[model samples]
Target: MASKGKISIIGSGLIGRNWAMLFASVGYNISLFDIDESRIDDALVDIKQQLNSLESKNLLRGSLNAEQQFSLIDKCISMEECLRNSIYCQECVFEKLELKVQVFQQIDKYVDDKTVLASSTSCLLPSSFSANLNHKSQVIVAHPVNPAYYIPLVELVPAPWTDEKVVARTRELMTEIGQKSVTLKKEIEGFLVNRVQYSILNECYRLIAGDYVSVEDIDSVMCDGLGLRYAFMGPWETAHLNANGMKEYFEKYSKGIYDVSKTFGEIPKMEGATADHIANELTSRIPLEKLNERRKWREERLIAITQLKKTLDKH
Candidate 1:
């Protein structure tokens, strides 16, 4: 855990490129590594295109032009070249356990003693990949939400053997790159955010499957109701602010919430009629022929929302 300076990114995919943009935007020299040399070339192209997109939209940080930002990203052809003199490394490889294990083993072999080795794994835990490595204590999951170039919530998940010092340094480094991080005290399946997301998803599935709502209507409920409020306050904070305080809110709603929770049905298999409904509604809004255009629209909308959130927080 040297202070944030030179950083390395392994697996230059979507998340990897985002991590590189994040660090480089803050003036860190970055080494980006990937097995396919062409992927490095492609990532460099994609990142510049992405940075230019942000620049046009005034979403990127710093005053660097797209060319200057592109220059900060060095395509490291070898693992040795990638880790050389790097203070920290962020792994954004695929989510498979074996693939992660293999990558971590190689990374541990090349990493400096003080370098913090972090993963952008959404599912695999640190112990699942780094347990047997010599640099195990330095390894942890620093999972980022996609479009990390704009939306910057990094979930800091440390395994049982991951050192406290390493976690602190990781959190500090992420903050330096203008990323918000929440540290998990103990490892849990899907971590905090994904678990909460999955709970809502399960309920959405049940609602659609039980014929209580259409798939499109279910999504509209979130977009029109819960999601708008979530832009300002989290569920717990909303509960606290709704009444006098958290205690009073819980006292009044505990039984009701519990009863509703108990009455919730099991998750649907999502294979037959439910799947058809979802497909029909989703395709209506975003036809397969226009998927790429729709994806761009979604990303832009998220970026706009993120900008709005920043403006609101400033006041």
Candidate 2:
């Protein structure tokens, strides 16, 4: 197959590897780079294993098979080599402000005017790192959820100076790669996903701190109850469907919701005895040694869900 284009993936971590796979699935020639050269080789090995495993499960994406997709990625020793002639550069470095800014500055020096510079940050705002770059207009955040291959939502956040055309093009590219995307109108501290996540987390922490619910039970509330509906539709859609529509739903439940909201209390600090207790409870169930095993278990389910969604959409 002819290549779609070149895509540069900076950092050889899980996110960067996943991004490479996502792009390579669509036949994009991927340049994978890392500051530590050894990690690049390790990433390639891991990527091969993952692609082959996905193929065995009949979960591999796009028209290409595992071998073909794997062949599309090339390891690059230097940032300049990775960004050379690439249409998009995705930075997947660690989430420190200074580190992200430094990486962006380095990338800015190598990137051309046309390449879309995207960061894989979950919480950091785009402007915080891109403000001083010459190619700030090209910088945007394309934050993907964990296990990005299965969870297709990619948040597209643009800095204040980001070009309108850049956002449009990035959205188009995301669509081409079979990922769902939501664009932010303006920059926010945590962006959409993390903000909503932290809100839920705050309540969960508060409940545990107040001895209202056990950690395991709180998780069950999500996995067994809310997650069932959330897998198919969002909260707004759930409310809309539960009642006649959104208007009727709000009208009937508004007072009760308000009463509950009033009692939610202030955000609890995610530390101290409560944090330790939660950790101990969770570790007892899954254990630190089995975390990777559990992660694999999670990914398998995500893949199954992705396939199920595709099959359902067909009907």
Write down the lDDT of every candidate, Cα atoms only. 0.87, 0.94
lDDT digits (tens) for residues 92-184 of candidate 2 = 999899999999999999989999999999989999999999999999999999889899999999999999999999999999999999999
> Over all chains combined, what TM-score does candidate 2 have?
0.97
1-315: candidate 1 lDDT, tens digit per residue: 133368999999888998999888877889999999999999999998988887887777866676677778899899988998888999988889999999999998887778999999998877888889999989889999877776778999998988899999999988988999999997999998899998998899888777798877888999998888887789999999988999999999999999989989776576887788788889998889999888788888888898888788899
Error of 2 at 244 (Å): 1.0
Q: TM-score, each model?
A: 0.94, 0.97
For residue 7, model 1's alpha carbon misses the true position, in angstroms, by: 0.7
Clashing pairs in 2: none
